[model samples]
Target chain A: MATLGEAKQMILDPAIRDWVLLPIMVVMLLVGVLRHHITVLITGTPKKPQLKAVRESKALMRGSQLRAFRNAIPPHAFASRKAFLTEAYDQGKYLKNPNAPKEGVPAPNPMTDPDMMEGMMEGMKKQVTNMVPQMLIMGWINFFFQGFVVIKLPFPLTLRFKSMLQSGVDTRDMDVTWVSSLSWYFLNLFGLSSVFTLILGDNNGNILYILGLHHYNEPIY
Target chain B: MARLDFEAASLELQQYRQSGERASERVAYLASRIIKDGYSAKLKDDIWPFYEQAVTAALDVGDFRLADECIENLKRRFSSSSRVQRLVGMRYEAEGKLADAQKIYDAILEEDESNILVSKRQIALLKLRGLKSEAISALVTYLDTYYSDAEAWIELCSLYLSVHAYQKAAYCLEELILLQAANPIWHLKYAEIMYTLGDYSLALKQYCRVIDLHEDHLRAMYGIQLCASKILDNGEADGTTEALKELATERILATEVNQCTIDSIKQVVREYLSVA
Candidate 1:
C-alpha cells in the first residue's frame, strides 16, 4: 500500500535508452514492414475460383437479395422470381454437389477434403510465420536485455501495473512507470501496429479474417 | 508540389491521369503530344497506362492512327495481358470489324469466364452491332453474377425499356431503386415505367418520392400531373390528387424555361391542371 508520497523513482541510464529502447522499437518497425511485404509476396494473386463454384455462390446471393428487396418489384415479377428460385432451391441446383446421395449421406471426412486440408495448412502456415519471428525476437531480447529497466512511461501508474510493466525485474517498491525489457517488447508490439497500418494499406494482415469475422460473414453490401 | 509552367498543360493533365481520373480528351491530346515531343520515352513504365487510356480516348475522337499506335505500344509490353487484349478488342470494334472484336472478347471469356471487364466489353460489342436481344440476355447473365452492380442494373433497365418490355424494365428499375435509394434518378425512372405500365397510383407514389428527394425535378412534376390526371380519368379522384395536381402545376410554372418555350409550356401546364 504505497501512497503517492512513498512511490520510488529510479533514474534510467541513457545507455538503456540508446541500446535497448530505441533498438527494440527500430527492430519492431522494420520487422512489421518486412512482415507486410512478405505477406503480400506470399499471398500473390489469389487463384480464380471455378466458374460453377462462383455461379453457385452468386446465385444464392441473388436469391437472398431478391427476397430481401422483394417489395421493390411489382407483384408479377416478384411472383415469377419466387417460383423460379423456389424451384431452384428445391432441386438443389446451386449446390456444389447436387448429385450426391440424399438419404443419410455421410459427413465428409476432414482429412479427405482437399480444400479443407489446404485451408487448414494455410492457416497453420500463417500462424507459425507470425509466431516464430515474435518468439525469436522475445527470446533475443530476454537473453541480451533482461534484468534491466529499458524505458519509463511519463505518467504515474498504480501498484496494480507493477507486475505487468516490471515482469523481468524483481525489485519491489519501484515505480510502475519504469518498464522492463520484456514489457518494452510488448509495448513495441502494440504501438507499432498503427505504424504498420500507416505504412501499409488498411487491409494489411487481413485483420477481419484474423479476428474470425469471416465465419460470421456479415453482410458487406 | 510546385505548380507546373503555363506551357506544361499536357504535363499537368498527365497528373490527373496518373492519379486515376478520366481526363480522356486531354490525355489523348497529351499522349500524341508527348510522343511527338520525345517526352514519351521518359515516362517508361508509366507510359503503359497512359497509352491504354489514350487508346480509348483516341478511338472516341476517331483518331484511328493514334489509337492504333497506342494499342501497338501496349501490345509490345503486355502481349498476353487480358487488359491489353481487351484494348485490342476495343480497337477492332472502333475499326467496324465487329466479328474480329467479338472473336477477341470470346477468346478472353473462354479463358476466364469471371473476367468482368471482358464480359462488359462483349455486351457493349453486342449492343454496338444493334443486337438488342443478345445484349439484353448477355447483360442479364452478367447481372446474375454481379447482383449488386448499380451500373449494370441501369443498363439492363434501359435495354428493357428500349425493347418495350415495360414490366421487365419496371423490375430492373425497382432493383436499381433498392440498390441506390438516395438517387432521385432511379425513382424518376421507376415512376415513368409505372406510368407506362398503367399503374398510375404506383407511378404517382414514386413521382412524389422523387419530389421528396429532389424538389425542383421538372419531369417528376410533369409525371405527377400526368399520373393525377390519369387517376382522375379512372374516377378515383380525391382531394389529395387535386392538391398534388395543383402543386405540380404551380411548381412547373414557377420553374425557369427558355423564352421561346415558356409560353407553350405554360399553356400545356394550364390545360393539364384544368383536366386534372
Candidate 2:
C-alpha cells in the first residue's frame, strides 16, 4: 500500500557519536554519582522518636500481638490483658495528649509545624537536585545534537514509538529503530542505573525510577 | 605504674569455675582496675553484664566492699534505669536484707508496673522469702502482662513442679514445645514430663521425635528403651506402636559401639527387659 523508496536514509556522522552520544552518557553518569553524595549529605543523622511516642506505638503493637496470639497464652492471662488494653484504649490513656478533647480535633497544619516544614524543604531539595541536572543535560543534547539519529536500537519498534524515538526529526517514514539523540539520552537516563549501582552501592542507583514513582504517587491537588 | 589489663582480667575470670575467696579477690582486683582506668569503649558496652557478674562473684566471696562499689557506680550512671534498680534489689538480697530488697522491687513496680526485669526479681525475692503462693501469683501476673518471655515460662514450670502440680508443669512444657517446635531440648523435656505423668505411649512418641530431631541423643535412647518396655508390659501397644518399639530396640542395639557407655546401656536394656 506504500511506496517502496519513501523511507529516508541519513548517514550518521562519526563525530556525533564521539561528541554527542558518549559525552551525554558520561555527563549523566557523573551527575548520578554526584547526586547520590549530595543526597546523603543533605539528609543528616535521623532524630530519635520521643519515649512517650515509642511507648504508645509499642502498646498498640502489644495489643495486636495479644489478639493474634491469644491461644498461645492462658485464658486468664488473655482475659486480663484484653480487659486492661480495652480499658486503656477506651479511656484514651495512651494518647499523646490524653487531656486534649478528642472531638473537634483540628487537621494538622503542615505550614505551622517546623518538623513538617523541614520535611517538605528536604523533599523540595531532592526534587530540585533530581530535576536541575536532568533539564540541563536534555537542553544541551537538544541544542547541540538536533536532527541527528545518534544510534540505532537492535530491536525493531512499532510506529506508535515514532514520536518518542524521532523527537527532533520530522520524517515519518524513518525506521523506528533509529533513535534521535534526545531519545538516546532518555534511554541512558533510565538504563544506566545498573552501571551507577556498580560504581556506587545499591542504595545510590535508580534515581529516575524513584523520581517516576514519586511523580506517580503525587497528590492531585 | 603498670597499665590496667581488662583482657587479662576477663580471661582470668573465664578460667575460674568456682566462686570462692580467691575468685572474689580476683573480681575485686578487676573492679578496682576498672574504676581506676575509667571507662573504655569495651567497658562502656559491657559494663552492665561485667558489673552484674562481678557483684555476684564478690558476694559469693564475701567481698561486700567491691559489690557495694559496683552497685554505687551503676546507680550513679543509670539513676532511673529499672535494670539498675533490679541489680540494687539483688545487692540487698545478697546482703541478707530481704525486706529492703522487697521495698526496692515494690518501688520499681510502682513506677513501671510492666517492667519485666523488676517483676522477675520481685517474684524471685518472694520465692526466696519462702512465700510460694505469693511467688506463684506474682509470676502469673507477670506472665499475663509479658507472656512471650520463655525464661519466665520455664521458671513457672519449675515452680509448678516444686508444688507437685504435675498437670500444670506438663501444660507449661506443652506451651514451651509449641513455642519452640524446632528445639529438640523442649521435646526431650516434654517427653520427661509425659513420662512422669505416666503417659508412656505419648512419652515414647516424644522420645522418638527427639531422636529424629537430634540423632544419637543418649538420654532419648534410654527414654525410648524404658517407654518401649513399659508399653510391652502393659500390652497396650497396637501393631504400629509395636513395630515402632521393635524398631527403637533394634536402633538402640545397633548404635555405634563407641557412641555410648556400653556397660551402662546394656544394664538399662537388661533392667527394662527383666521388668517386662
Cα lDDT tens digits for candidate 2, A1-221: 24435444556788888988788889988888888887778775455444355556656766776666565444654687689889998997666667866678886777998878877887787777777777788788878888878888789889988877777788877889898887777778767888987888567735554556456423411
Off by over 4 Å in 1: A1-26, A47-50, A57-72, A100-106, A151-158, A173-178, A194-221, B1-88, B91-104, B165-167, B174-184, B190-217, B227-251, B254-268, B271-276
Off by over 4 Å in 2: A1-221, B1-5, B8-49, B60-62, B254-256, B260-276
Please report, as a residue range, the 10-residue window in candidate 2 chain B with the lowest summed lDDT: B13-22
Best candidate per DockQ, number?
A: 1
lDDT of each: 0.79, 0.74
Candidate 1: true contacts recovered, fraction: 0.35
In candidate 2, what are the lDDT values of residues B1-276, reduced to their tens digit?
788777877666555533433466667677667766874346644676677767776776777887888778778888887777777788888888999999999998787665666768888988998898889888877665555567877888999989989878877766565456567887888788889989898888889889888987878877887887788779887777667666666666667345556787777865664454
Candidate 2 matches the true fold with a TM-score of 0.53
For model 1, the local distance difference test gives 0.79
What is the Cα-based lDDT of residue B27 in candidate 1? 67
